[model samples]
Target: MSERVMPGRADGLITLDAADALWVDLTADSAVPTASAAFTCSPAHARAGYVLLGSRVVATVKASGGQWSVLETEVRRAAAELNAVRMDRQDLVRIGPFRGAPKKERNETTLLRWRQRITRELQELGESERAVRREGGGPSHLAGIDWRRILVERTRDRTARTWWLPRAVVRLLDVAEHTETRWVQAARTCQENTAVPEPPSHPRQARDAGGRQTTSPKGPGASLRPYNGELEGQLYSVLSGKPGTSRRVAGWVCAVCRTAPATVLDHCHEHGYVRAPVCQSCNTLERPDHLYSNDIRVANHYARLFDTDTDDWLRHWHRCPGCRARTTLPLPHLAAWTAHIACRSLRPTHHAPRGRKPCGVLRVSWTGSQNAPRSCLLTVAVDFCPSGEHRVLARVPYREAVERFRIWLAETAPAVAAAAGPDRLDGLPAQFRPVIADTSGEGLALF
Candidate 1:
């Protein structure tokens, strides 16, 4: 009998009749044949096949060779242009539905016209109301805004509720135009124009609302008089040189204390201005007359002490014990850490004397990043001692303090942690952790 060989890793031989039987067999136990021969299906076809299995295909696009790339490029470019137009129109309708017509003329009639115009534009761009209404993917930042509010309201009835862009449909119009959401754009624009003073080309005395020239006897205005021209010119130059600085400064999220959006533009009351913005808490905590108030050195100082990142003024900069003495010294890590733990334990008195000072003393001081932009000064001190008097001990720059703490913890924490018992892990905040045995001599491995 003649033997037939099956391709690939198959049993030795089979008769033609047996091969035909194998091909015809559809039993669950039968092995399916596999081959890497030329596949007639292209990647596009395979993708299409998978997509066809789905309920809906958003867009059915066909492209061949170089035309595909060109089409893609054109689509993207056209899309971007359309998005810009849509957003600008949306903003226009949002802020002024009357399209700069007199305020008295703005009413439901004008709003209907504006909506019709937008709808026509969308249709011309080959987009339908259904497409515009479809929810696109992204995070929504405005918590207070209800976009569904009327786009235009009658001037007389504006007191109860005013007009806003139609939210349900318009918000879904273009999700990508979100740099300045319509909800906050007006507030942001107002803040930018008014929050920071614009220097006049020529030094004219700043006037109050009554047209009387305002005087600042003890404030920034006092220093502005003598060098008004020079200062004003410099201020203009600085502000203009860095165009983004104003926006960044105004939009600053407080780096100090990790607080929410910073409202105050921090500056040197004496030197005029610095670029960084600080939260209300950090800005108000220190006396304005203090040396570090306008200096980045102050920011660096506190960051080092707490092993935190520094980009602005520290809230506790005034807490430096050596500020009065004008000299600071290094505090041992062991003593500083002990004092930290002790300070954490002390609670505030409910009805204590109103003017009583807290029980704490500065023991250590350090300065890091000197002569550099990032230069920082750090001071560590003990608070809540048994004796009424708080004594100054040592001070080191924040960087050194961090290293000292890390080293001390690494060296001493293992034994201490072992002594903490199994209960050491319980009732502790996520940040507080017992020392591990594998601590390095270089520093505390964990924060």
Candidate 2:
């Protein structure tokens, strides 16, 4: 209105100057070609002010700051309103322009829209049906989102708004450097809470290859190496405390086996005192709970199972009743053989050892043929007491003795035969399986 030409909306130049608060250079020709404006008359205008919006400037003055304060308050109100409008527009664009709802109300709506877009993209990729069933935060959902597409879209949208996603991640990582200290502290705390304590070992100082002394953890055996005299005195005291135990030399053989060298200072685990010095083999069995009272028996049992030199074992330990009675045959066969031997014993009719009369006499004999050496006739007879009545139990070939014995066993001692269970031959070595036509009656019959 003042006839000073204004800059056109399309092409104009705006500038600030020391003499003038505001100025505009116009591109379109006008009546007044040069334009300048001053917001205040004072060289240093502190209270007086102006509002510049693009090429327009609204100037104001006040008496002692009264009117200027009112104008300033109004300017602030207008500014807040403009900022709110901008933020609201940005919010609409962030979600959807057509949503016509606040960010809080539209958050789910926007999520649903993205979810649908992701689902469609995954379908285009020909993913399996399970992809849809996966949770929204799962790898399948992550794959469906297409991060490249998201980045591109975000960049495109930011370009439209004349802004950008700054290097915020780099800036955040810089801040995270301080947070890394917490991780170190957490690791130390975890070790303190979860570490386990171990038993302390004796310290041994020894020279390393460099000849410098180094201390290492030593075990019980290592701790005992330098105390042989003290150990011997203790062993002597322990032996003297026991009524029957005797102190023996280092090269002394085991008291039990009398074969292996005595090495360990055997002690009762319960009593915590040495009983004797014994070999490793004897010490295993000579515990306080089941002490080797019969060392011969222990030696004999072990000799049967593990010892190869039987002649020495027989000379020393076989005098034991258990050793003398031990047999290679199975228990069932042994019982049967015992019964057969008792049945074959013969004595006077109505025989009495000193007080009682005998029940009967049983006779078992074999008559072999000259032509067939392996073939023989088995004869079994029983004689009743006092009446002197003779009755034949079985008369069969020796090869058929097993069957005859089984029949006689069932008749004579039915309980024993019944206890033997089913007739199945066993204990015959694998090599004998070929020579034996049948093993129907376990080794009880073969014997």
Candidate 3:
């Protein structure tokens, strides 16, 4: 018997008859053949034969050069045909019985038109295939090639050369690693059978015993309610009633952002009134009640729409009395601003009337990319009383600003104690004591 050399395992030698027998064994079973199988072939021999068959198929297909491209063209043509058929059916539904024509006649004419269109499409497809055949690129030339197995193996080989990681394969193919693995398994089955695998069927909703779908229309949880067409119509009417709106004058551009093309009708969910046409992003942001209040630009723009003053909108920017510079800060920074002012008041340089402590109003401002909250320039300003001049007190990095505030709090603890009197220190507000105790490095009982 003539001997053949295997690619792996140090160029292992096996008889041609034994190799044929191993190939037969691999194809005969759905699962990988074991050493104890009736064919008496080891798993290694079976794997080697399987790989050999796959390589031969790949080589045969490659010999036909651009046959895969021809196959892809055919696939796209078929998809276009399917879409055309769907559109034709929709046209028939919309046209119904043509005017001055009987129902039967209308259907027969429609069927004839469809048949003619389909025949023309099929003739074009046949001519293209014939041209490919003339160029030595056709289904006959690539018969028994198992293209799926070839593709999967090629993907695996390329991925192995890089990092042998599924993520690397995913980046190349734009598919989940698990899905790629499933494709590999399916391709292996095709390799065993020496046949092209059929496209996998899409998963469909489960059907009950009565043949009705059991899945909810809303989805798995059944949380979403069906859309109300009447309410939508009413909203559309209200939107159209408004003159010189973006939807009417500027086409479909977003009324708020004026960037993205509008896709949805923005409305007040509480009042059930239409607002304007906006993009999906703006519509989502508008859902929250405090959206306008938090965004000054949006608030001012909407206020103008209603012909109101800018001050009618939420004011986030304040001008310093001393420096006369505008300071913009969000509402959340108000607490920190107040605390910083109180700390400044306790400074020895801030003199007050004989029996009273100095009182002041504080405003906070920050500058940085909103995406990077940790790194920011935090500035605090205080309007000191009597003179009532508002000036910037501390301008530092966010972390440094916080540290300085804490240090000021620690230094002011003795002054706070003295003002309240030692006996009255324990009677300070509960909320004020925890902050003082923590910063002063003293137990809460010491307050």
**Alpha-carbon TM-score of each model against the true structure:** 0.21, 0.15, 0.17
RMSD of 3: 29.8
lDDT by residue for model 1 (1-447), tens: 113223321112222232223222311121211111101111112111111000011111212221110111222232233233222222222323323232223232221222334333333433254245434322111111112222344354643322335322233322211211221343244446665532121012333223333211121111211111211112222553565654444344444444233434433222222324444334433222122322221221232344432112222221122210111112222223423432334423223477644454334333433222146554544435555344333344445544454444334344322332334333223341222211111111110
- Give per-candidate clash totals: 21, 3, 0
Task: List ranges where model 3 is wrong by over 4 Å.
Answer: 1-356, 384-388, 401-447
Could you tell me the TM-score of candidate 3?
A: 0.17
* RMSD, every candidate, angstroms: 27.6, 42.8, 29.8
User: What's the lDDT of the predicted structure labeled candidate 3?
Assistant: 0.29
Clash pairs, model 3 backbone = none
The deviation in Å at residue 24 for candidate 2 is: 99
Best by TM-score: 1
Error of 2 at 307 (Å): 32
lDDT of 2 by residue, 85-203 (tens): 21111111121111222223323212222223332444344335434533233222111111221221233454331111112211111122212222223334544654542211113
The lDDT of model 2 is 0.29
